[model samples]
Target: MTDSSAPADPRPRSALPLLVAILALIVAGGALWVSYGNATKLAASKEHAAVAPPSDPAIEQIKETLSSLQQAVRGIQADQQRQAERVGDVQQGISIGCDPTEGLSTTGRAKVALGSTERAQHAG
Candidate 1:
């Protein structure tokens, strides 16, 4: 069939894929640039830390105060130990060789005495 009745069309094709590719490349480049900037900042901070910082008087004063507090605590512990030894000596001196009879009530003690007396009478 040879029907020559329609005209030739002259429209361009859609380039959506190419536009998306270019947008992705731009986004990737921006991300890389931000990452590089952060890396440089971290590097600069590390270099500053590597250098020696100036000594502050407040820190030295705090260190001295800490040492004094430690000394005071040690003194208090030594005093407490000496007092404990003295108390031990006093307790040992006051201790007597006797049976303890404080836990039983009066009724319990009477029952125990009556039972002992009845046992003695039966034995006799």
Candidate 2:
């Protein structure tokens, strides 16, 4: 029942081995892709972990000054509110003008206008 003259099944038996090798290679490539993705996510998470300014003394001092200035702004805002409330019965809106170079502290005048309160709230 075997036709030995039919060109020996007309295909190389090594075809099976080649197919298996290709499949193995594809599986290995998928595993490598997954591993690389995980490694990238791990690296990105490490990079995103609450990075901040260096812990140098100068940086710490600057942070402290910023915090103090933020509190001062809150205090000033509260005072302004109180003043507004106290003069609610006045006939006209309050008008106070002074030189920018003389009326306010340099740092206060600079950052206070930049919504430092909101920025500090987030930086906290």
Candidate 3:
């Protein structure tokens, strides 16, 4: 009735945009698929790493060395404390025999006498 649609109007108006949209959608889907695959592969690698046991002997040796050093430090601290106690005991014993008015200045003698008195009080 309209001269066979005038040769189908030569070109469809919506064809080009529709083709572009379809292409864009395909590209987006491909990109998403690629990213998903990469993410899955990364997750699998992490899982494997988590499941694996520690394999380095040097790390274990270092841990053992650190523990030994800690023990040595504790022993050294105890020895220092014992030596300090012995020194304090010797000072108190010396203070008990010495006259506060001889050889030592007034302030020094007072400090030594006070230390001896405090040590005696604490010991008793």
Candidate 4:
């Protein structure tokens, strides 16, 4: 048996395997980091694509058509308003009769009275 009191041998331990393992871990970590970055980029691109407006010409044309239809509807509504105003003016002047003391002559009043009498007779 060797004597326990002898000074321990001073030979340095081989650090090669430990260094290699640490290097491998670092390389693996770097690879994982790169993969994560790439995944993030891909996800962002997908999200952007999902939110992006339509690029198709047909879709654009449909949008334009809808806008034109809305403008046409507004135009039609304006036309209806003008026609309604004209009808109101005509009704006020002729059917309901305007101020009798103004432009209307006696013969016109007699005719209006006859027309009203006829309408009342028809209703009853």
Clashing pairs in 4: none
Per-residue alpha-carbon lDDT of candidate 3 for residues 1-124, written as tens digits (9 for 90 to 100): 5786476668657788899999999999999999999999999999998897866999989999999999999999999998687566656766897453355567856876798799999999
Residues 1-124 of candidate 1 have per-residue lDDT tens digits of 6457643555656799899999999999999999999999999999999998888999999999999999999999999998687556544544763222234468745765687689899999
Clash count, one per candidate: 0, 0, 0, 0
TM-score result, candidate 3: 0.53
Ranked by lDDT, top first: 3, 4, 1, 2
Candidate 4 global CA lDDT score:
0.81
Give per-residue lDDT, candidate 1, residue 124. Answer: 100
lDDT-best of 1 and 2: 1
lDDT of 2 by residue, 1-124 (tens): 9887788667656788899999999999999999999999999988888676568998889999999999999999999997676445221322443332344467645744466468888899
Q: Candidate 4 has what TM-score?
A: 0.47
Each prediction's RMSD over C-alphas, in Å, is: 18.0, 18.4, 12.0, 7.7
Q: Which candidate is the best by lDDT?
A: 3
| Top-down TM-score ranking | 3, 4, 1, 2
State in Å the error of residue 17, model 4.
13
- Which candidate model has the greater lDDT, 1 or 4? 4
Give lDDT per model, in order. 0.78, 0.72, 0.82, 0.81
lDDT accuracy of residue 6 in candidate 1: 48
